[model samples]
Structure formats: structure tokens, C-alpha cells
Target: MFRSLWFDGRLRAVLAQVLIACGFAGVVGWLFWNARHNLMQRGIAMGFDFLGEAARFPISEHLLAYQPTDSYGRAFAVGLANTLYISLLVIVVSTVLGFLLALARRSRHPLVAAAATVYLEAIRNTPLVVQLLFWYSVVTLNLPAPRQALEPLPGVFLSVRGLFFPSVSWTGDLVPLAWAAGAAVVLLGARFVYKRRHRAAGARGWPWLALAAGLLLWGAWQGQVGLQSQAPVLRGLNFLGGASFTPEFSALLLGLTLYSAAFSGEIIRSGIAAVPRGQWEAARSLGLRPWTTLRWVVVPQALRIIVPPMTSQYLSIIKNTTLALAVGYPDLSFVITTTINQTGQAIEGIAILMAVYLSISLSVSLFMNLYNRRINRTQRP
Candidate 1:
């Protein structure tokens, strides 16, 4: 049996793979061991024991209730929330602005296309940190003082102080809204499953799926229509606000959004340009309107090229949120830096920061990969 196994090509290949795996594992183990030994020799504690210590420094911008006396763990959580909020905001705003700019690039008017090209070039050529600083300076220096805040809309004020706008404030019981949301989710989930099954069976249910989604949303909205709401109003000195954005945060958000959008616009234009010329000719020959041809034929195909690169852009947007520190926005990177300086645990602080960022990137990649897979599966005959 041993002689037969040795003579078999499959068995030999398997043995080679096993040996390579063991060698790789040994190398990794040795590297880890050497690092640990060096760290110990330097008397630098590598454990995460400092996460529980009190953070005596103040974070200027945080989502949760965090005091200077809060534990580093709590500070970390606040910083994380701020990071996530800014990231999400940038992703959405950049995506919409990017698509619009992409459309402008393809506009029939020469002025529109030229303007978009100039805008895209302006953003793409400059470093993002410079853009952040520029916006910060503009907002802080150019805007009117709070006493003479510019009221762009009634109850909304913009000034050197910050931007103040109304936000949704719930005054009634939230249980009903929760129930409606739950019902909508169940309805949408079932509809999604039905669509998947039909898709696998090579049957189409576009109208049914649309109707189901519309009904679900409509029902949810109707159920929550009577919920109490509040709106912010302008007060004497400052706005009696629903939500207020500090100058630092506003500038950081604007800079990131505009900068990311330019890159996204280039991705979109490339995706749309990738479609075969024959597809356009075919659509035009069928006597379809320009908009109809684009919506029905061109854009759908372009999405195939757009999704993967767009996913990378989304991850980039999240990673760039770290630059908020330059604009004085207290994102995760800023908090970690302060924590590192105070605690003298540079290693642990950096490790935590790396882990958090790695997790966020992985999460974005995972979601986008799944979406891309669904698109691929549906495209396959």
C-alpha cells in the first residue's frame, strides 16, 4: 500500500501541498515568536489591558455620551461611531454626486461636459488632505459669524460657528414604528425569496416584485404616518436645533464627499464607455428615445463593469475618513492617537486601530462581493 501511494501522482501532489502548508505555518509561528520576544525585551506590554483605563482627554466630535473621565473602551466606542457615521455619510453623498457628475460628463451640452471635466480634474489632481484643509479654512474663515448667520432656508442657519438644520425628533411611542418596520422587513424578505426562486427557475417576476416592494413601503409609511414629530426653530443667539454640525465636521464631510465623488465619476464614465458601440446602434435603430435607450439598455450593461471598482471606492471612502483628524474631526484615528500619547501604549493603540479599519474594509468588501455575485448569477444563462 505504501509503495502504491508513493507511485500515485494524486497522493504525491497531496503530500507536497501538506508539506508546503506545514512550512508556511512554521515560518509564521517563528516570526510571531521573534516579535513577542523582542517586545518583551523592550519592556513594552503588548496586551490590551489599557483599553479599560480612564481617558482624560476630551474628544471634540463624538456621537455617543463620552466624557473625559470615560474609560478608553467607551472612548473607542464613541470614536468608532463617529467614524462609521462619517463614512456612511460620505459613501452616500459621494455616490449620488459621482453619478450626477458622470451624467454631466456625458451631457449633450458642451458647457456641461467641459465644466464636469474641469471639476473632476480639479479634485483628482489635488491631495485629499489639502482639500480637507482648504474646505476647513473656507468654512472657518469665509462664513459669517453666528450673530449674522446666513439663513439659506427658514430655521436652517449656516455660519462660521457651524451649520444648523432641523432633524427628526420622535415625541410619540416608537413601538408602532418598530412594528411597522418589522412587518415591512418580513414582507420584503418573502418577496426577495420568491424572486430568487423564480430567478433560479428562469422565470421573470419584475412587475410582481416591484408591486410587492411598493406595497411594503407604502404600508410601512402609512402605519407610521401619525407618529408625532418635531422640527428645529431659530432662537435668539443660536439655533434651537434638532441637529448641529460643527465647522470641522462640516468641512471634513464636504471635502471627503467632493473628492470621492470625482473619482467615482471617472469610474462611472469608464463603465458606461465600456459598452459596445453596437449596443448603442442597436438601441437607436429600434427607434428608442435617447433616455429610454440609456435606461433600458446602456446603464444595465454598464453596471456589470461598475460594481467591482465601485466597491473599492466605497472602501477607499471609509479609509479616507481617517484624514478627518487634519480637519479637527474626532474620528477613530484621532481618538486612538490621543489614547496612544496618554497611555504610552503605542503598540496596542495601533493594533486596535488596524483591527477596526481592517474589519470595516472586510465588511464593505463582503457586502459588495455578495451583490456582485448576485448580479453575475442573474446574468448567466
Candidate 2:
């Protein structure tokens, strides 16, 4: 029986894979044991007990509320929030900028095409770190000080410290805002379902949009909610009473958006190019306008090619947010570094950082893959 099993190709393959997996697990176990033993010998502790301890470090900018007395876990959460906020902004801005760049490059106008080409070449050839540093210098060294800040628009101030603009706040009941948000979400969901079911009719979501707006207006009126806009005013040496973007954050956003957009533009351009010329001819024969053809036909077909590489580009941008450290922006990795320095729990801190990044990357990939599959399904007969 043993001889026969060894002769069976399928059985042999299974046995070989099992052996490989076992060997890998064994090696990993040994490495862990060795590391633990060494650490014990040096009296270094393990585990995550430090999470509840106060993290005295300061975070410059965060979406979530944070204080110096907050626990290490809270500080990490703040860092993760900052990372996500910047990454989300970069992804959105880059995608739009990239689409424009791709279109300009494909334009028949010589000057437009040349300008796009020049921008792409220059951006793509340089290291992203250098671009980030250069932008940092422009914001920090070249910009005017707060006392002599430039007012580019009403209630907008640009200075070495940062860009400050008016922020709107709803001074009213929270219940109305919650109801309005819920109504908007429901309307959007219904619109999505309508689009999927009636693909041929090309249903517009304007009605849904209008309904959501009406609901919001009604809610605001009932709740007596009023929007209060607070503009920044020069206060002594700095600006006060408005939302502001720090110099570091502004530099990081500008650098990441421009840098990622160049690559995204190239990827989009290639995908568009990959579509057969016959597709364009077919679109033209249908008497469709150029913009309509590109929008409805060419782009949808090109998406099959675009999505895979674009997923990678997005993942890269997420990871690149770590470069925030160079500009002193307190992203997840930055927080991890500080945690390690303060607590000497290098292993735990690094593990948390890796896990957070891995989770984010996987989530993004899964979403894009689903989107890719949907497009692929639509293309099938």
C-alpha cells in the first residue's frame, strides 16, 4: 500500500506540499523561540501590556480627538486616523488629477499633449522623497510668515504656518443631522439599485439627489439648524477661529497627490491605449459625441485593463503615507516609532504597524477586485 501511494503522482504532490508547510511552520516556531529566549536572557519583556499606559508623545494633526495624557492605544488610533485621512484625500485627488492628465496626453492639441508629457516625465523620473522635501521647503521656507500672510480669497489665509479657511458648523440639534445623513444614504442606495435594474433606461439619480436635498432642508428647518461659518482671523502671531492645514500636512498632501497622479496617469493612458481601434470606430459610427463615446464606451471597456494596475497604485499610495515621517506628519508608522522609543516594546509596536497596514491593503484590494469582477461580468455576452 505504501509503495503504491508513493507511486501515485497526486498522493506524492500532496505529501510534498504538507512536508513543505510543516517545515516552514517548524522554522518559524524555532525563530520565535530563539528570539524569545534571547530577549529573556537580556531581561527584555514581551506582550502588549504597554498599550494601556500613557503615551506622553504629541501628535501634530489628527482627525480624532487626542490628548497628551491619552493611552498608547489611543495614540495609535489617532495615528491610524491621520494616515487614513491623508491616504483617502490623496487617492481621491490623484485619481481626478490622473484622469485629467491622461485625457490631456491623448488630446489632439500639441501644446496640451506636450505639457502633460513634460509633467509626467519630470514627476516620474524624480524620487518621491525629493519631491516631498522640495514641497516642504516651498511651504516652510518660501511662504510668508503669519503676520504678512497672503489672503488669496476672502477668509482664506496662506502663510508659512499653513493654509487657513472658513469652516462651517451646524449649530443645532444632532438628531436632524443624523436623519438627513440616513435619508441621503437610503436615497443613494435606491439609486444604485435602480441603475443596476434598469441599465437600458439610463436612469438619472437627479430625482434621488433632489429628494435627499429636500429631506435635509426639511430636517434643518424643523430642527432650526443654522450653518455658522467661522473664518480665520489674524490673532497676534497666528491665525485663529478656523480650520487650518499645517505646513507639514499641506506639503505631504501636495507631494503625494502630484507624485501618485503621474503614475496613475500613465496607467490610465496605457489602459485607454490598449482598447482596440475598432471600438473607437464603432463608437463614432453610432453618431455619439466624442466626450459621450469616451465616457460611455471607451472608459468602461478600458477599466478591465485599468483596475488591476490601479489597485496596485492605490496600495502604493497607502504605504507611501509612511513617508509622512520625513515631513513630521504623525502617521501610523510615526506613532509606532515613537511608541518603540518610549516603551522599548519594539516587537509589539512593529507588529501592530504591520497588521494595520496589511489590513488596509487587503481591504482595498478586495474592494477593487470586486469592482473589477463587476466590470468583467458586464462585458460578457
Candidate 3:
């Protein structure tokens, strides 16, 4: 058996792998030991027990109400939530805007295509931090005081502080409105089914719109649209009575979204390009309108190509949210930094930051991988 093991190619490969892994482990262990020894000699604590200590700093953008008396653990959670909130909002806004920009890039009008190209290039070339500061200082901070706020329209107010819009308050019974909208959606679905069954253009292309309008009108008539505006009121030297947006948060989100959307737009463009010219030609030959062909044929195929790379851009935006610390945004990294300074727990703070980022990256990767697998499985042979 020993002779056979020595002679077998598979056994030899396994033995080689084992030896290499053992060598790597030894090297890593030696390096870690040397580092720990140096840190100890320098009187730096390397353990993570400091994580349980009281964090005596205030977090500015905490999702849950946090006080200076909270523990380091609680501060970490607050920071994590803020990071996630910004990332979530940016992702949604960027994806929608990017898709529209990408579609515009394929427009028949030369002006539209040129404008899209310019926008994409402008966003992509600028440094994200620079853009963030530009928006904050030039756009947001330069606006008039809340009392003298710029009103773009009746219910919307913009100022140096933040945006103030009419907040929706659901009053009357929303059940009827919900039922009406749901029924309209169901009817739209049924129309599609009927079109497929009968092979006819369904109701001259306005049935869905009419259904939506009818439902909206019915809902409004029933007083289901309960919304009121509490305009920003000047209180002493500051604004009051409306939602306040911190400049740091706004800057971080704006920078992240603009930077990420550029890449997302490119990914979409490339995905559209990946669809064969023959597919477009075939689609056009079928008498389908340009919009219809794009909706029914091109986008579905492009999505398979677009989604994976798009996920990477999303992960990048989430990671880039760390840059918020530079602008004093109370994101996870900022909170951790404060915790480190107050507690002198470098190892603990760094460990917590690393763990949080690693978890976020891993979660994103897992979801993207699952989506990629699903797309690959459904791909045409």
C-alpha cells in the first residue's frame, strides 16, 4: 500500500498539497507570534475585552436613539445601522437613475445620447470626495435660511439645512384604496393573459393607464390621500418643524450614488451591447415597437449580464460609505474611530470594524452569487 501510494499520481498530489498547507500555517503562526511579541513589548493591549467598555462619545446619525452612556457594543450597532441606511438609500436611487441614463444612451435623438455621455463622463472622472464636498458646500450650504428657503414648488422647500417636503399621513380607511389598486393590478395581469391567449393587442395600449387613473381617482375621492405639509419654520438661529438632514449624511449619500451610478450605467451599456445585433434585428422584424422590443426582449437578456457586475458596484458603494468619516459623518467607521480614541482600544475597535465590513461584503457576495446562479441556469443553451 505504501508503494502504491508513492506511485499513484493522485496520492502524490494530495501529499504535495498537505505539505504546502503545513508550510503556510507555520509561516503564518511565526509571523503572528512575532507581531504579538512586539505589540506586548510596546505595551499595547491586543485583546478585544475593551469592546464591553462604555463608549463615551455621541454618535450624530444613529438609527436607534443612542446616548454617550451607551456601551461600545451599542455604539457599534448604531454606526452599522447608519452605514446600512445610507447604503440602502443610495443603492435604490442610483440603480433607478443609472437605468434611465443607460436607456437614454441608446436613444435615437443625438442630443439625448450626447447629454447622457457627458453626464456619465462628468460623474465618472470626478473624485467622489471632491464631489461630496462640492455638493455640500456649494449646493446645500449656500442656500438661504429655513425661513427664506427656496421653494421649487408649493410643498417642497430646499435650504442650507435639508429638503422639506409634504409628509404623507394616512388618514381615512386605506383598505379600500389598497383593494382598488390591487384589483387594478390584477386586471392588468388578466389583460396580459387575455392578450397571450387571444394573440391580440390588448385594449389599444391604454387599459392599464386608465385602470391606474381610475383607482387613484377613487382613492383620492374617498379621502384616502391624507397628506399635509409642516413647512420648515425658523426658530431662533436654526430651522425647526420639519425633518432635518445632516450635511454629512447628504454629502456621503450624494457622492456614493453619483460615483456608483456611473459604473452602473457603464455596466448596463455593456450588457446591452452583449446582446447580439441579430437579436435586435430579429426583434425589430417582428413588428414590435422599439420600446416594446426593449422591454420584452433586450432588457431581460441584458439583466443576466448586468446583475453580477452591478452587485460589485453596490458592494463598492457600501464600502465607500466608510469615507463618510472624512466628512464627520457618523457611520460605522466614524463611530469605531471615536470608540478607539476614547477607550484606547485599538485592537478591539479595529476588530469590530473589520468584522462588520467583512460581514457586509460576504452577505453581498452570497446574494450576488445566488442571483448569478439563477440567471446562468435559465440561460438559453
Highest TM-score against the true fold, candidate? 2
Given candidate 1, what's the lDDT at residue 30? 95
Assess candidate 2 and give its lDDT.
0.93
Which 10-residue span in candidate 1 carries the lowest summed lDDT? 222-231
- Model 2 per-residue lDDT tens digits across residues 1-381: 999988999999999999999999999899889988888898888889999999997888888999999999999999999999999999999999999999999999999999999999999999999999999999999999999999999889999999999999888786886788798888888788777787835666688789888888888877888989999999899999989999999999999999999999999999999999998999899899889989998998899999999999999999999999989999999999999998888888988999999999999999999999988985535
Q: How many clashing residue pairs, candidate 1? A: 0
In model 1, which regions exceed 4 Å deviation? 1-44, 198-237, 378-381
lDDT of 1 at 368: 95
* Model 3 ranges off by over 4 Å: 1-3, 168-232, 379-381
The residue pairs that clash in candidate 3, if any, are: none
lDDT at residue 22 of model 1 (Cα atoms)? 100
The predicted structure with the larger TM-score, 1 or 3, is: 1
Please, what are the lDDT tens digits per residue for candidate 1 over residues 1-381? Answer: 999989999989999999999999999889768877888898877778888888999988787998999999999999999999999999999989999999999999999999999999999999999999999999999999778889899778898889987776544445655665666667667867986877656655576567666765565565554434444565666666577899999999999999999999999989989999999999999999988988999888898899999999999999999998898899899999998888777767888999999999999999999988877676455
Give per-residue lDDT, candidate 1, residue 268. Answer: 91
lDDT (Cα, tens digit) per residue for candidate 3, span 1-381: 899889999989999999999999999889778867887888776776766777888787777988888888888888899999999999899998888888889888999999999999999998888887787685465878777878898767777776666554456777778877788888888888888789795357586779777987797667556765565666776666656567677777777888888888889988998999988899889998988988999988898899889888989888889888767789898888887787666766787889888999899889988987887785345
- Compared with the true structure, all predictions reach lDDT values of 0.87, 0.93, 0.81
lDDT accuracy of residue 72 in candidate 1? 96
For candidate 1, the per-residue lDDT at 316 reads 92
